[model samples]
Target: MALKKKKSKKMTSTGTDVNITSLMDVLTVLLFFLIKSATVSSLELTPPKGMKLPTAEMKEEPKEAIKIALSKDMLVVDEKTMVKLDAGRFPASYLMEDGRTIKPLKEFLVQEYQKKKDFYKDVADENVDLLPPPTLLIQADHKLPFGTLKHLLHTAAISGFADYQFVVETPGE
Candidate 1:
């Protein structure tokens, strides 16, 4: 009897097939982390001290603003007054060359109004009507009474400056 030869079975590897689900999960997690890392910050600006401003009923704020100053015995605009600042007694020598120096509060406000009006005409864009009105910020010492501020406001109104903003300290420290 001849010996029978047994054939061995050949083992072949299966073709490479990658599972895309795992890769897609990793990509999605990376995308989520990248988006979460990004951030934005907001900023706000505040005015200086001793310049506490009065509030208005309107919620929206204006773009253009002007500042005026009030002092004892005299009114000044933007901290600059025609009359000189002194502890006591008004000086005679401090006078403008035009001879018509600022002696009254109304005159000072009127002068400022005229200047602003002319300036608005020169720089204002012609295309836009009802342009932003210039806001007048009046800063008066706490000691000063409301009468002075009222006069200043009246003067501004007369000179076509209808918009007004009062600068004052908040009540109660």
Candidate 2:
């Protein structure tokens, strides 16, 4: 029997490298989408110092309004210092002698109304006879006294801010 020469097989190597550039591009797009959606769904409101917001069951979304923030030590209107609380008391500069109407607050509201009216007048159509009423948003601490809130509402009504809304926190499910 003739012995056949043994044939040696050449060794061939198979590479196992993985391409991750496409996967990285997809993950980057997903991250961007999540960040954009989170910002769009969240409300932008900052409570003042020492203020804990009240919780409510209401589902209505708040509209644009002049924000009035009330904390234990200060009262801010649209980020402007309206009154400084002294020893847990409302400032005398804002309160009238009768202690019923908040004069300074009313005056500020009237000035704001005038400014908005002028702006609207310049931008509104001549055929429009009346403009929509302005809205006011009150952000009061949960521990705030009822009497203080009552006075604030009364003052706001007198200042022609009949459309008012209270800012509160909604309990999470």
Best by lDDT: 2
lDDT scores in order: 0.54, 0.79
| Pairs that clash in candidate 2 | none
Q: Give the TM-score of candidate 1.
A: 0.41
Q: Any idea what lDDT model 1 has?
A: 0.54
Write down the TM-score for model 2.
0.73
lDDT of 1 at 88: 26
Per-prediction TM-score: 0.41, 0.73
- Predicted candidate 2: what Cα RMSD to the true structure? 6.1
